[model samples]
Target: MNKKEDSPSSLDLIWGVSEIAKMIGRTERQTYHMIQSGNLPMVKQVGERYVASRSKLIAFFIEDAA
Candidate 1:
């Protein structure tokens, strides 16, 4: 099995794109575009899903607000 598969499925420190979008009041497509445009930090791909760091997302909002 690959190392990724060997890793734990439970993520304690990250959020998926949909979850982050809901928190930030943006659509999933918008979030994906942000990632594509480098407006938002890149995400780590897990299987077929993209995951973002919760802390990073919070920081992004804080920076944007500043």
Candidate 2:
């Protein structure tokens, strides 16, 4: 098997809007607004769900704290 097959999928690192909100302690609506307003990193939508990159979210918080 290849390393890619053994590793988790990219989707695994992608978080839903609600999950992102919980991580940042914000409301889902607020999170959506942030995304809409371009205040937050862009996400990839999968069906009805919005998926944000975990690394981007972490970097955003780290930068905010700086």
Model 2 lDDT per residue over 1-66, tens place: 688756665644656888988877899999889878888855767898888777777888899899
lDDT of 1: 0.73
| TM values, all candidates | 0.66, 0.69
Instruction: List model 1 lDDT by residue over 1-66, tens digit each.
Output: 687756655442456778767767899999888777888764676887778766667787898899
Q: Clash totals for all models, in order?
A: 0, 0
Model 1 is weakest, by summed lDDT over 10 consecutive residues, at: 5-14
Every candidate's CA RMSD: 4.9, 3.0
| Highest-scoring model, TM-score | 2
